[model samples]
Target: MKLISWNVNGLRAVLKKDFMTIFNELDADWFCLQETKMQAGQVELDLPGYHQYFNYAERKGYSGTAIFTKHEPLNVTYGMGVPEHDTEGRIITLEYPNFYLMTVYTPNSGGELKRLDYRQQWDKDFLAYTNQLAAKKPLVYCGDLNVAHQEIDLKNDKTNHHNAGFTDEERADFTKQLDSGFIDTFRNLYPDTVTYSWWSYRFHARANNAGWRIDYFVSSRDFKPYIQDAKILTDIMGSDHCPVELVTKDLI
Candidate 1:
């Protein structure tokens, strides 16, 4: 089935910018959204044949995520079962008969690394959560993870080396996540492809194609061979980020 993930930046804002048009065009079996930036009741969406699930931050107009799926899940979970991490509404896991699908909006380390420590802790906790889930069944995890894993991921490696998303510590954390046996579907499928989902809103970064490949569709090792395709839909626009998509048959 087709699955797509996009960090809409702000769901409410994107809604006014033809979000529905793209949604209709893509026609994905499942659409996962990150950084929705709105609390409950802030926006109303009409998706005729999809079942919707949303996790909103307690703070209004802040970090949030939602999933729209044509196939209903057997069970759905919000957060990582950790209060500190759950409060941000950064994750949602949907359990099906065969696997678990998780949509995540990883926290940024902040411009000056002010939140680096918390971000590190979050990485550890999220990895642990994924591991536990993997132990139960195969998994497909996707979203804007907010980290550039290597020099090849961003345009100016030397200049961005010390930035929050490209810091040694953050990259190492991402490496650790992959080392734990999850496959980064996109990178694995197109080893030489070098596009990105997110770019700086300032500096006309997206227009210039100066960006980092921070979004992903990572799956458990056992399911890697089933990954039919992984892509970065750079042509689409609504938020600072474009969409990243993945395909596999019988997602359940």
Candidate 2:
């Protein structure tokens, strides 16, 4: 099975770019998206042979996520059942017979760390939610988690030490999540790889290759065997973020 996750920044915007061409080329069994930034009825897609699911934020043109999959899930759920956190429409979980697949767009710690406290709470709650699913079956969750994780995950680690995605608090929270029996698929596969999934649109960041590996495919430790390979498709262009992939053996 091929699973692809991308932070499109904005689905409508990218659709105007090379999204359809790139999406067709990847041809994943499961394609998950983050930061869709639109509500229902705003746009319609023409993806053949895929079941689509979306969680739209209460606020229009804000944070949102979507999943398009070849296989129909046994069940589909939106949000984590946390009222405060559910407003942003950041998470969607699709339950199959053998495993659960989730897509999340974790909240960003806003300018000057204004939203840091909220983001920390989100991390804790999000981890708890994943734990609940993993207890029932193995889980594969992906999206822009909004953290650089470690020095190697970002290009300007020293200068970005206190930035939103690179802050110590955010990184520690991600570490806590990983410690709870989950594997960061790409890093687990290529420990020394320095490729990044997200680059700022400022200062010619992409051209300079100054980026952060913020997007990811994470799975339960016991599910590791199914993950044949993980990749950061840096060459793909459209959004400020590139798509990340996980190639897996059949689960069903």
Candidate 3:
């Protein structure tokens, strides 16, 4: 099975930028998206063979997530069941007979760390949610987690030490998540490699290749054998973020 996760930044915007062509070329068994930034009825997609699921934020044109898959899931759920956190439409979980697949758009710690406290709480709650699913069966979750997990995860680690995504608190929370029972697939596969999934649109960041590996494919540690490979598709162009991939052995 093949899966792709990307933060399109805005689905409506990308649709006009050859998104269909790029989507067709990747041809993943499962394609998950974050930061769709739109509500229902705003746009319709023409993905011929996929079952689509979308979770739209309560506010229009804000945080949202989606999943398009070739295989239909046994069950589908939106949000984490916490009203406060669910309001943003940040999560979508698709349950199959053997595993659960989730896509999340974690909240960002805003300017001056104003939202840091809430983001920390989110990390804790999100981990608990994933832990529950993993206890039942294997779990594969992906999307823009909004954290550059380590010094190696961003190009200017020292310079960005206090920045939203690179802050120590955010990094430690990610470490806690991985320590709990999950594996960061790409880093687990290529620990020494330096690649990034997200870049700032300002300052010619992409042109200079100054980026952060904020997006990811994470799975239950025991499910590691199913993951054949993980990749950061840096060459792909459309959003400030590129798509990340996970190739797996057939689970069904």
Could you list the CA RMSD of all candidates, in the order they appear?
0.8, 0.7, 0.7
Q: lDDT of each model, Cα atoms only?
A: 0.92, 0.95, 0.95
**Candidate 3 per-residue C-alpha lDDT over 55-100 given as tens digits, one digit per residue, 9 for 90 to 100:** 9999999999999999999999999988879999899999999899
- How many clashes does each candidate structure show, in the order listed? 1, 0, 0
For candidate 3, the lDDT comes to: 0.95
Mark the regions of model 1 whose C-alpha exceeds 4 Å error after superposition.
none
> Candidate 1, after superposition: displacement of residue 7 in Å?
0.2
lDDT of 1 by residue, 1-252 (tens): 899999999999999899999999999988999999998887778899999999999988999999999999999999999998999899999998888999999999997899999999999999999999999999899999999897778988899887889999999999999999898998898888788888888899999999889999999898776689988999998899999999887665
TM-score on alpha carbons, each prediction: 0.98, 0.99, 0.99
Deviation of model 3 at 18, angstroms? 0.4
